[model samples]
Target: MKKFLLYFLCLISLTSCSLFPRDNTKSVKEHTGKKAEEHQITPPDDKEPNHSLLENTMELAQEGKVATSNFAVHMNSINDVKKQWGPAANTDQIGGIYYANYPAKHTVFGYNAKNILVDIRSYDEQLHQLTYPQIVKTLGKPDYLRTNQDDQIYGYKITQQFELRFIVPKNTEKVDHISLLSPNDTVATTTPPYILPIKGVSKNLSVTAWQNMQNWRNQMIQVAKNHQNFVFLNGPNKKRVALTFDDGPDLMNTPSIIETLANYHLKGNFFFIGEKVKKYPEVVQKAYTNGNLVLSHSYFHHDLSKLQAVEIKTDLAQTEEEIFEVIGKKPALLRPPYGAVNNTVITTAAQNGYKIVLWSIDTLDWSQMESSNIEYNVLKNIRNGDIILMHSDDDKVQTAKALPHIIEELTRKGFEIVDLQTLLGQKAYK
Candidate 1:
C-alpha cells in the first residue's frame, strides 16, 4: 500500500485527487502541495499531551458515551484529534507526514502539513480483537487482501474517502491492530522518522556555486507576484520539488531522460521546443503518454522577450500547433526561452491563455558540465519547493546520466518528486 504519493492518491480518489491521471479541464487549485518541515508533532500551546479533551468530549458521540473508535477514525483534522485526544504521547515525522502516537489510549494519528488527518490507528491488546475467521464472518471478505512475511492485511472500504484495515498475524489468526486511512496517507518510514542519507548529497550544505542565479531567482519571485500570467517560479517551502527539462524531444537525451524518469516512476515537466517536436514526434508523444507534461518552450527556442508582440504570439501558436499535433492537446504553460521576459511577452502570454513557468534552481546542464558537477548543482542547492532546471537536448548526455542519481538522492532524503501540475496545482493544458 505504501508507494508513490501521486499515484496512490489518484487511484484511491478515482483519479479525482489531481496528482496523476488528473482531470484535464479541472484546476487542482484546492490542494496546496506544501510539505511539512522535519520536526516532531507537538502541542500548539507548548503544553504536554494531556487527556483534558478526552474527558471534555467524552459525550460528543450520539450514543451518550465516548466512542473512541469514532473519535479516532472520524475526526476532521489533527486539531479535532488534538481537541479530543489532547496531544500525542510521542511524535515523529518523515517526508511531510507526522505520526503522533497515544500509547495509553492505544491510538496513533497521521496528518499532513495542512493538519488534515491522513490516518488513525489503535492497538489495544486489552480489547478482545477479531480473528481472521471472525473478520471474514462479520465483514464478508475484505475489499483488498495483502499478505506479507509477518502479517496479512485485510482492507475494507469504510467510506468514500477512507479505508479500514485489520492486520492479522501470519501464523496466528488473531487481529493485531486496526487502521483508518485515506489514500493520501503515505506509509510512515519503518523506523518512523529515519530518512536514509545519500553518500555525496546533503541538503544542509552551503554551496555558493550560482550566487547570481540565486539572487535573480529571488527577483523573479517578487516580479511573478505582480504578474497575473506568471503562474509560479517555485512552490512553497516544503518537502516536494518539481524537476523540469527544457529544449528536448531529441532522439537520444530526450528518450533517455524519459526512460530514466519512468524507471523511477517520476513525472517531469518537459518544456520542449516546437520545431524539434516535428523532427522527433514519437519521442515527444512518448513523453506525453508516459505522464510527462510537454509544455511550450517556443516554436524555435527564440527569446520571446526580444521579439515583437506579434512575433511572440506567432511562436506561441506554432509551438501549440506542433505540440497539439504530436500530443493531441495544447499546453497552457510557456517557459520563455532563457527565462527572458518583458511586459509585452507577459501580456502576450496572458492574452493567449498561457502562464509563464519559471524556475528556482538552474542546473546549467546545457553547459556540458561533468556528471558530478551536475549532481552537485542539484543536490547541494536543493530545497523544499524548488523548481529544478535542466536540459534534455541531444548534446546534454551528461544530464541524462546525472538524472537517476539526482532522483535517487532526492528520494533518499525523503523529498517527493512531483510534477508542476501537482506542485503548483495548476492546469497543464488549455
Candidate 2:
C-alpha cells in the first residue's frame, strides 16, 4: 500500500511545471465501486468522510481555496502548513518555488520566495473514480482543456489571479489530482479533445447474479467499441438503481410520475422528447427544478437507426437546444427513441457529446400492464446497477399507478435509488 513519489524538478523556466513523478509510477489501483469511494478529496481514512466535508471541499475548490479544515488558514507560511498536515514526506524546488509533498495526506504545497503558500496540488485518489462529465456537472465546462505530460488538464479561471486545474491521466476519464493555484506559479496550458467517461463494474458484487451482470456489461462495452463508439447499458456495478422515465413532459402521466417520486423524496431520470418538451415547457422546468434530471430522447419518436448521420445530428441538436432552453444546460446523456441505434446513430451522437444510455430492466409500462405486473417486472429481475426503464407519456396510466409501489418496495429492499449522474458517475448536463 506504500507509494514512493519521485520528485524530479525540471529546471526549465519556459514551460508550465508539474510534480512529474518517478520511482512508483504505476497507476493507482484501478478502483471500482466501493473501493473508489474509499479515496475521496480528503486524506485516506477508515471511516467514511462526512457528506458535508465532501461538499465543503468541492465548494471551496471552485474559488481556488482549500477547505478551512484542510489547512487553508495555514497557507500563510510553510511553517504553518507543517504544523497541521505534518511535515512534507519530501521536498523539491523548481525555478525558486519551494514545494512540499505529503505522501500520506496526498497533498503538495508550493511557496514563493517569501515562503508563503502559492499553490495546493492534491493527488488524492478520492477523485479517482470521477469522470469528466461529473466534474462538468459541478463546475460547468472547463475554461481550458489542455494536455500536460501524460495527463490532460481541465483548467478553470476561478479568478483573475488564480486557476483551478484538473489532472486527468491519459486514456482514463478519472482525475489523478487537482491544483488550486495562482497564475504566476504556472504557465499557460493547451487544450485537447474531449475525454470520454469510463464504464466499470462495482466492487460490492458478491452474489453470482451480480457477477453475471458485471460480465455481461463488460462484454457489451467491448462489443460496443468494436462497432459503435460506446453505449452505457447500465450504471456502475453497485447497490444503486436508477428509475428512468422516457417520452415525458406531458400534461398527465409525467406529472403524476414526478409527483409520485417527490412524495417518496426520490429523483428519477426523465428523457423528454423535444416536441413534447416544447409543448410542455412548464413541465420540463418543474421536473428540472424539483431535482430530477431531464435528458434527450431525440426531437420526435423516430427510429434513429434508419436516419442518415446528418439527419440524426440535426435531431440531436434540435432536441438539446429545446432541453437547454427549458433547463439552461445542455444534456450529455441520450436515449435513442425506441432504443434504435446503428453505428451511424452512435457515431453522430458521440460527435454531439452524448453517451447512449439504455435500460437493463424494461417494466413494459407502455403495454398498459396492471400495476402489479409492472412491479413484478422490476422487483423480480432487478440486479445491481440496473437502469429500470418506464414511460411517462400522457397515455401510460398503468405506469403512473405502478411507480409508487416500486419506489416503496425498492426502499424496503435497501436498494439505493440514485440520479443518473450518481448512477453513471458522469455528467447529466453539459
Candidate 3:
C-alpha cells in the first residue's frame, strides 16, 4: 500500500513540471519582445535629416574620431591625412606651410615640412546661424574675450587651443563674419606682413630705410597740402630717376616691359588708362604684383583740361572707382591725359585726394620713335629726381626693346631706376 501511494505522487509531480515548461517559455519570449520594442531605433518624426545637417553630422563624427586630443600634432603626412579623411576640398601653401581647407566641415588643417600636419582648426557656423544665446549654450563661456572699437570685432577664446572671432556690426546683434584659430600654432598668427601693394618692393628692408621712406612720404604729403593745384614733378635729392610708362597695361607690350624691368632688378610705373584698365585688369594686377607703380592716366584718356568740371570729375571718379575695385585701394597720384591739366583738372583732382603727376622728360615712345632715339632721349637728359615718360602699348614695341638698355645704362651711370612711388617717397595707393 505504501509503494503504490509513492508512485502516484511522483506521477503528479512530473505532470506539473511539463505543464509549467510552456508557460516559462512564453514568459521569456514576451520579455524579449518588450526589450526589442524599447531598444529599436525609430526614424525622427520629420523623416529625413536636412542634407546640410546630415553632412555636418557625418563630418563631425569623422572629425571626432580622427582628431582625438592632440592628434593633429602627431599626424605624419598629408598622404596619411588623405588616407584617413579623404582628399581636402581645397589646398593652399603660404610661408612654407600647406593648408587643407574643408569648407563643408568648416575646418582647416595645416601641414609643415615633409607634409606633417601641424595644426587643425575647426570653425562653428553656429556663430552666424544661431543667436548669441545659442552660441553661448553650445560653446559654453569663453576663457577670454576681446573687443576692438575700430573694427567692431568681438573675439572669444574658448581654450588655449581654440579661439573664435566675429565681426559685430554696429547697432546689430547679428555676427556677420566668423573665424576660428589655433593659438598654439605659430602659422596661425604669422600672416605675411601688410607691405603696400607695390610688387617687387622688399618688405625685408632695414628699419632705418623704412623710417626714411616714411619721413619722405610725410614731407611730400605736407607739401601737397600746402600747394593745392601743383603737380609734383620730382622727388627729394635721391640719385634716382622714375621710369614711367603711360597709355598701357596692354597684353602685348606690358608683360615684356615687366620682365625686362625684373631682369634688371629695377622698377617702373605704369599709368593705366581707365578704359584699358577695365579690359586688362589682370595686366594691371601683374604690374602691381611685380612691385611696379600703377596710377591713373584718366578713364577715357581724354584731355581733362578741355572737359567741363563735371565731366572731368566723372571721368576721374570712374577711373578711381575702377582702380579701387581691382586693387582694393585708389591711386594717390594722377597723371592728366597728355599732361594737359588746367585749373579745373587740378581742383577736381585735389578734391579727390589725388596729387597731379607730370613727367620731367618725354621719351616720345608714343610717337613710335626708334629704340635708339628712345634710349638717347632718356640717357642724355636724365638727372636726379627726373621722371622719364615711356609707353607700354601695342604701338610702343620700341619702348619694350629699349627698356633693358635704358636700365643698364642708368644703372651703369650710378642712377637707381625706381618707380614713381619710391622715387617720390610716397605711398602708391591709399
Candidate 4:
C-alpha cells in the first residue's frame, strides 16, 4: 500500500500539481470556534477515481515486496517519506509503510508484517477522562497546568511534541478532551524549490510572474526592517503595497475604495482617526470585514512628533480604545498623522505596542492630480518594493479614476501590489 501510494504520488508529481489545497487567505492563528473535524484519506494508485479502500488494501497486500519495489508514486519524495519515518525501521512486503514509537519521544519506521502503522494499546485509562487523578495515572501529574487557571482541564508537554491542551466545559472541573499537533508541527516549510505550473497561462509567463512576486515581497520586508514602524499583511505573493487613506472611515469614499479592493481580490490598511471609527462604525466594520487592517491614526490626525509625552499617550490610547471598541481588535500599527515621527513619537508608539508605518512612495493624489498623471507617475517609478500613499477619501475623484490603471500598469511591469499588513509582515489588528 505504501509503495502503491508512493508510486501514485510520484506520477502526480510529474504533472507539476499537488493534491493539497492551495488557498492561503486563512490566517495561521488557531480558530477556537466549533468546527467539524476533517479527516483526509489517501486516494487510489491510479487517477481513475477509485474509492474502494478494502479492495485497494487487498490489492496492495497481494503485490508483496512493496518495500523493495520501486513503484513510482507522488505525495512526496521517498527521501521525504523516510524523514517522517525514522531510521531503524525496516519495510516488509505487505505493502504500506508502518512505524512505531516507544514510551519515549522516539519514532521507529518500517512496514509491519500486516502493513500498517503500529499503535499498540499500551495502557487504557479511558476512565481517567475527567479527573485530576487521570493526569497522575496517565502521564504523571502536571508541572504547570495545575497552577494555570486556563489549563486546569488537561495539560501535558512532550520534549518536542505539542503542549497538549484539554478544553474542559465551563464550570466543570473535568477535562473536555482535545488534542493538538505539537508546536514543532507548525515549523515553516522551506520555500518550494520550484513554481507549480499554472494551467491556461504561458509557462514562461507564469514562472516570471511568480518570480516577480517573490522579489517584490522580499524587497518590502527589507525596506520595512529599516523603520521602527510598518506591518505586513497577506501572503508574500499577493501584493505588498499599502493602500492607506488618512482621516477615514470616511462615509463618502470609504465604501468605494472598499468596493474597488474587493473587486480586485485585495485589501488595504486604514489609518483612521478615532473620531471616524466612532462616527462610522459601519464603515469601520466594512473595512475589517473586507480584511483591511484598521490602525490608529490618532484621535484626530495630530502630529505625534510635536505632542508632549502625556498628550501623545492620551491621543494614541484614546484612538486605540475607540478603534478597539468598534472593531474588537486593537491596532498594532499606527501611521503618525501626516507620516510625522521623531524620538518622542517612536518611544510613545513603542510604549503602546504599535509600530509606526511610513510610505516609501507618495502619489500626492491628495493634490487631486489628473488621474492620468497619478497613474503614470505611480507606475513609472514603481519597483519591486514600494508603498504608494494615497488618501481613501480626500482625492476621491483622482484616486478612484487612477485605481484601475495603477493596478493594471504596475502589474504589467512585473510588480505585485499587496496590503500594508502583508508588506510589513505584521498580524492584522483584528
Candidate 5:
C-alpha cells in the first residue's frame, strides 16, 4: 500500500510539470495573438509615431535628399503677407539669387549668375532721386524686369533714406521709359516727374540737368534773346558766342553746370571724349535731351592732327558709334583732340560729315588757375559773338568752382550763352 501511494504522487507531479511548458514556446498561437492585440490597441494616429515621421522628413532635407524645400510657393503681391510674421521672400534668376532685407534696410535687387534679376526686397529710407542716366551711370546695366506686347519693364531702385522701387517701362517705338512707380507711392502713368531713357537721349529730358538747362535758357532769353541756335552759331552778322565745353557730361560736375546754365537759361556745345561718355551715358543723354549739342573730342583723346588717316578715321568712327549708341544721335560736330586740328584733320572730319568747330576764346579752365582768376578771365573775355571754351573733366576743378561766378558775370553782361547747334543753324547729329 505504501509503494502504490508514493508512485501515484510521483506520477501526479510529472503530469503537472509536463502540462505547464518551461520554454516560451508553450503556445505559439497564443503568443502571436497577444502581440497582435497590443499592436491594434496602440493606434496609428499616436503622437510618438507622428513625431518620428516629422524628424525623418527634416533629416532627409538636411541630408540634401531634396533639391528644395517642398514648402516653396509663389507670391504675386506682397500685400498678402502679414507685416509681423515676415515670411522669407526671395527672387531667383538665372545664375544669381539673393535674400530680402538680410543686412540692410533699403529695397535691393540683386543679380543672379546670369546677371538677371534674381532677388528684390523692400528697403527703408528715401534715397536721392535718380534719373535713368544716373541709374545707368552707377549700375552699368538695365535689368529686364518684365515685358509685354506694348512695353518692356525695367526695374530701378534707389538706396537712401527710404528705399524706393521704380518700375520703368518703355514703349516699343519711343526712346524714353516712363516711370511706373515712385517712392511716394505715386504711380507713374504717362510720365514720371523726372525720368530718362534706359540707353539713349529722349525726345525731351526732365532730369535735373535738363531742368537746369531750361532755366538757363529762360534766363538767357530774358537778357539777350540773341543767344539762339544750339551749341555753335553764325548769324548774318556772324556776331555769336559759341558756348563750348570739352571733356564732359561728368556725373557730378556736369549736372552742376547744367543747373547753372538753367539758372541762366542757356545751353552749350559739349565736346565729349568717347571714354567719358561711355562712362556716363546718362549725363550725355541729359545734355542731348536738353538741346545741348554733343560733339566729338576724340575716341581716346588722341590728337587727330598727329594720328595717321586710318587712326583718325577709326577714332572718329568709334566715338561716333558710342555717341549714337547712347544718345541715338550721332555727333555732327568735331572738336579736334586738344584743339590740335590741321587742314588734314579738318578734311577728315568733313569727310565724316562733321563740321570742324574751333574755339575763339580759351578760358584755360583746364589749367590749375585760381577759381576766381579763371572766373575773371572768362568774364573779361566775353564778346557779343565770342566762342568761349571750357572743360568738363573733374581734373578741371577750377572750371567747376568758377562756374557760378561766370554765369553771374555773363548774366550781368549782355552776352547770352547758346549751344553750337543754335549758333550754327545746322542740325546736330546728337
Candidate 6:
C-alpha cells in the first residue's frame, strides 16, 4: 500500500511539471512587450493560420535546417516550395528578383526568377530568439560588423562553411532576426576585401587609388631632383596630377562622375559645399568610399575672403559636422570657395585643424564651357604636381562628358591620377 502511494505522488509530480512551460525569461516578449503570438507567421491566403496549424508547421520546421515549413535552404525548385508551403501570403518582384513571404511562419524566402532558392529568413519569433548581448555571449565576436542606414549587422562564419547574420534593428538593442545563408550569397561575398565600404563605396578603389597615387608621388620626387626651378605645390615632384572636383555633389551628376573615376581605377578629390553635402550626402559618401578624398568647399560656398574670421569658422565647423555624420570622419583639408581666401581664412582654417587646398590647374568647367574646351584646358596645361580642378555638381554636363577623355589623355601621357591627400602626403580625414 505504501509503495502504491509513493508511485501515485511521483506521477502527480511529473504531471505538475508537464503542466507548466519552462519560463524563458530572455524571450522576446520579456524585452519588447510583444508576445510571440503577435508576430505569428501570415498564411498564403491572406488569413491567419490557426494556432494549431502554426504549431504543427513550426514543429515540422524545427526538424529542418532553417525551420521552414516545407523546403530547405539551397532548395532548387519553386514548384517544390509551393507544393510544400502551399503559396506565399505575399510576393514581390524587383529588378528580376522574386521574394515570397509566409507571414504565418514569420519566414520569407527569396529566389531567382528561375526559382532557385537563394535565401531564407526568419523574423522576430524563433526557437532561439536572442538579444544582441546574448548573441555575443554565445557566438563571441563576429567576423564582420557593419551598419546599413540604421540597422546594424554582425556576421559570422560557422565552421568556415555556412554564414550567419544577426540583424539588430535601429534604436533597439535586441536582435530582430537571424539569417543562415550561404557564404557566397552574403554581403561579404558581394563586397570584396571583406570590409564594409566607408560610405558605401568599395574599399578596393581606395586601396588601388592610394597605391597609384604613391607611385606617382615617387616619380615626381625624382623629377624635382633634376629641375631645381620646377615649382610644384601640393604634389610630389613626379609627373602625377591630382583631379579635384568642386561646387556640388548634385543628385544627378556626381554619381556619374564617381563611376567615371572608378572606371579608370583612378581617384579624385571632391570639395563639397556644405549645403550641397547636406542635400546629397550619399554622393559624397560614395566618393569617400570609392577611395576618393572628400574635403570641404566651405559650408555655403561663399568666398572666405569676404566672410569675417568668426563667420568662416562657423561655416567650416558646420561643414565638418555634416561630413562626419555621413562618413564617421571629419575633413582634414579645406578649399575656400572660388579659390578666394584671405589671411583670416587661412588663420581660421589653421585654427580649425584644416589645411587650405587650392587648385594648380583650373579646368574652368564651371564656366559651362564646351566639353572640347574643358578637355583642352585640362590636357593643355597639365603638369606634375598640378591639381586639376573640375566641377562635379551643377548642370555641368560638359564636364561629365569630358571627364573620361581627360582621364584617358592623362593615362596615355603616363601621368598618375590621384587625390589631393596622395599628392600632398596628408591624411584625407580626421
Among the numbered candidates, top lDDT falls to: 2
In order, candidate lDDTs are 0.66, 0.68, 0.59, 0.49, 0.48, 0.60
Q: Cα lDDT of model 1 overall? A: 0.66
Q: What tens digits encode model 6's per-residue C-alpha lDDT throughout 39-119?
A: 332223432224442244334333323544445545455457665665555444322234566767777665543456655
Candidate 4 local accuracy as lDDT? 0.49
Candidate 4: residue 52 Cα off by (Å): 71
Work out the TM-score per prediction: 0.51, 0.50, 0.47, 0.46, 0.44, 0.46
Q: Write the per-residue lDDT of candidate 5 for residues 1-430, one digit (tens) a residue.
A: 5554322212211011121112121111233543211322222232222333223323432332211212111211221221332322222111112122222333333322222322233222221122333333333334323332223223333321122122222332211212212122111111211111111122234588556545543433322211111112222234446667888868777777766676767787789999888889999888877777888888788768788767888899999988998878788787776656454564465446666665545565654356766665566655555667778777766677788787667767755666766665555673
In the range 98-204, model 4's lDDT, one tens digit per residue, is 22222232212222222222111111123224444433443444333311223332334433332433334335544433322122221222122111111111122
**Model 1, range 205-267, lDDT digits (tens) per residue?**
346634544555556655564442244677766799999999987899999999999999999
Collision pairs in model 2? 39-126, 40-126, 133-427, 145-191, 146-190, 202-237
Q: How accurate is candidate 3 locally (lDDT)?
A: 0.59
**What lDDT score goes with residue 52 in model 2?**
53
How many clashes does each candidate structure show, in the order listed?
0, 6, 3, 29, 45, 8
Cα miss at 98, model 6 (Å)?
A: 64
Indicate the TM-score of model 2.
0.50
- Using TM-score, give the best candidate's number: 1
Decoy 4 TM-score against native? 0.46
lDDT of 1 at 92: 45
Q: Candidate 3's residue-wise lDDT over 86-139, tens digit each?
A: 555544444434566555665566555345554454444543443333333433
- Sorted by lDDT, highest first, which candidate order results? 2, 1, 6, 3, 4, 5
